[model samples]
Target: MSGVWVWVEQHDGQAASVSWEAVGLARTLADGLGEPVTALVFGMNAAALAQEAIQRGADNALVCEDETLAAFRLEPYASLLSGLAQERQPDVILAGATTRGSDIMGAAAVDLKAGLIAGAVGAELSDGRIVATVPVYSGKLMSKVTIPEGSPQMLTIRNRAFAALEPDAGRSGEVETVAPVLPEDEIMSKVVGFEAAEGEISLTDAAIIVSGGRGVGGPEGFEPLQELCDVLGAALGASRAAVDAGWISYEHQVGQTGKTVSPDLYIACGISGAVQHQAGMRTSKVIVAINKDPEAPIFKLAHYGVVDDLFKVVPALTQAFRERLGK
Candidate 1:
């Protein structure tokens, strides 16, 4: 592991957007440290993605194509990544702070005894060590974490925190085929199947989101917000209180205990902007809060505050957007 290593997260041969962002970060860090960027890709029939990784900025790629890795099972993925890290001894490892990326990286860190920085909003090489900027105390403050000079420095980058470089289709690099570290029979766990959420945008990848809270009143109260989301082509999200109240599923929860999001625009309806919820979406580029309570905490941090009833306001906004966008 003499080079800067980035684990390119992929699904069904398509790469995650954050994987490319991590590559962009890796390219910058590698340039500063005078190291080559090496991408590690694993999945069934992921050779094309390996090539795409090179086009995105990796100097070379190590690809592992196996049926065992077709679905992300922790046992095989972690075993393969950790074994490779031990053998190659990469100076640094980067991955997206996605479910699979975080899972495998955490396991690899334990196996290799490497220092891992999770949920890093930004990072740079300082004094030959990685200094990662992490949010703490529910986004109220930023904490700087420095990985000491030892073992491989690993980091899971928060989505949208770094810009991905435009791919150069003409660029060429080396691609090395690798094998899985564990045998199928030896692995304890297996991926039975996947039940993906349909017709909904991923919160981490969404550019815009329309979220509801306790203020939405009940499960049916989310209908107006859903309409708004449809008009905006945005993902529907919810505060923990709404989720706890059974108004929405946990998958739609956006808070410290749920999925972290960093969208370009976040419209919070009937949300009180609790610190817990803020931790998940405080990084959104533009925050708009629509609450009847003028003194709602969400108004304090929102770029635009609409003090009104969300039921009334949301429908109006949806209709306006539909008319304007010609939807």
Candidate 2:
């Protein structure tokens, strides 16, 4: 029978947070569809990991294990997963819009001959159909799309758009193994060396972000905000203005072309809040703007606004937070 299935991605046997996030989103969708949430785990040592789906609210977890599956491989994963979906006839399949997730989704979509939607932020299950919300035109626009005809409708959602769900101890289920899943010889992609990023937490995963822009004067001006961010246990972010002006690295930029963040709190220091910048962080739970010009567009969307020099105001705010949070 058809149900909501989440593709769990793991790295070296460790579960990816994006998979848990997908499980959370799938649980909501399943609740609306009045169906069960089943996570599909494909990798080695999956026995110890199946409990995650149940603890996180999945009704059942479908495990397909292999030693070769310990690493990500586009060819075998796409072949195996799409083949399974065809056999099981799931109502819908959801995955994170991570680089790797998007790769697998695209490959599987072609094989399944199914309609695909990327960067979905919202979903609704009603009238025996799944309607997905997707952003368009570099996030300048948005639209709702539905698959009129498909056995397993597919969608990939932007990370952090949905809040991660806490484990629900009351909800428990079983882990079933999908028979004859994949063999090492059948897998095409092989694991090479991994260059893990060091000493930097990406803005996409941060809960709090302290961002600066061209108005911050120069690259050196970001120091104070960095200090504040460090004290706040937050990540550093930059506007396109700062990045374009060569004041900050593109990796630090938050915009349509850069990373999109829906942090718990987003503090903009001297940023003018261009459309692109807003596109990235407009969904933040709480927004604070520290720009001298009250006329700046940033204040229009900010929950809190200060019309003063950021150099003076930001330090004061930082001190206040440090005194309060003792950081």
Candidate 3:
């Protein structure tokens, strides 16, 4: 009831950008509610991340850097977070809707018996409670959920839904070190190996994304899209059809069954933009569709449409962008 809290997620000592985005949202909500923002850091380099959290927006930070907390193991991390929330009694808790973020939040919410609003696009203070705006029915409709008072309101924010504040180097805040709630022996799960995709920007964190679908043909079809992605310094994405066709890996799929993305610009090439696909990228700031069929469903939601063969248009666009960018 005293402060607003943000969960700072990190990997290999580097904090995820979405974590800072959550901190930014927490700062705004905290200011409005007249409560301080406290960032919770539970991993390697927690102290440094705690300071960066303050630079981003938090008023203070609570850090726990035990060996067991070094890598993200669910049981220990969630137990620590839940215990802290129960003891401190924060008004609200916010986290990025990444896989790890969502997992930890859901587990902690179960422990605390608190209401959790997942993948919220917008939030505001209403009558001393938090009202979260969430997309429902495959992004076809939006519903608002208001968290009641008494327990800490929890929300997982969608990526790119809100803007992050500029960091101020001079900004300073208190960093409190805390003990891990669970012992290493009591933690059930273990992280055996971590293999991250090399050289590809994560779709969720990409500012711009270029996606391919059924029109792209086979695995070789993704080469053109890769060229465009390289030219634009954007992430490469695919629809479920393309993924199922082996045109691209499942990691690149963007749809209801794939990763949700809200980039500044989303370019759909050879994609029909089915409702399932729209569910993921519908919240993008700008959308462009290119397909031979003018009647493609993707054109319905696109801000700009190109009725031409992707083979002819994609290469032309890539070359134009390369020359324009001098790359």
Across 1-327, the per-residue lDDT of candidate 2 in tens digits comes to 579988887777777777788889888888888888888887786766678777887889888786656677887677778988888888888888888788888999998898878878887776777788887776778898889876688888887777668887787788888754567777766787898765766787788999999789998999999989888889999999899999988889998899888889999999999998998888898999999898999999999998999999988988999999977
Question: In angstroms, how far off is 272's CA in candidate 2?
Answer: 1.4
Q: How much does each candidate deviate from the true structure in C-alpha RMSD? A: 1.4, 2.3, 1.0
TM-scores for all predictions: 0.96, 0.91, 0.98
Query: What is candidate 1's CA lDDT for residue 98?
Result: 89
**Per-model tally of clashing residue pairs:** 3, 0, 1
lDDT per residue for candidate 3 within 1-327, as digits (tens), equals: 689999999999998888988999998899898999999999889999999999999999999999999899889989999999999898889999988899999999999999999999899888778889998876778999887766789999988887788889999999999999898789888898988899899999999999999999988988998999999999999999999987678999898898888899999999998899998898888999999999899998999999999999999999999999999
lDDT of each: 0.91, 0.84, 0.91
How far residue 16's Cα lies from its native spot in candidate 1, in Å, is: 1.6
Ranking by TM-score: 3, 1, 2
TM-score of 1: 0.96
For model 2, the local distance difference test gives: 0.84
Where's the lowest-lDDT run of ten residues in candidate 2? 179-188
Judged by whole-model lDDT over C-alpha atoms, candidate 1 comes out at: 0.91
Error of 2 at 186 (Å): 5.9
Report how far off residue 181 is in candidate 3 (Å).
1.5
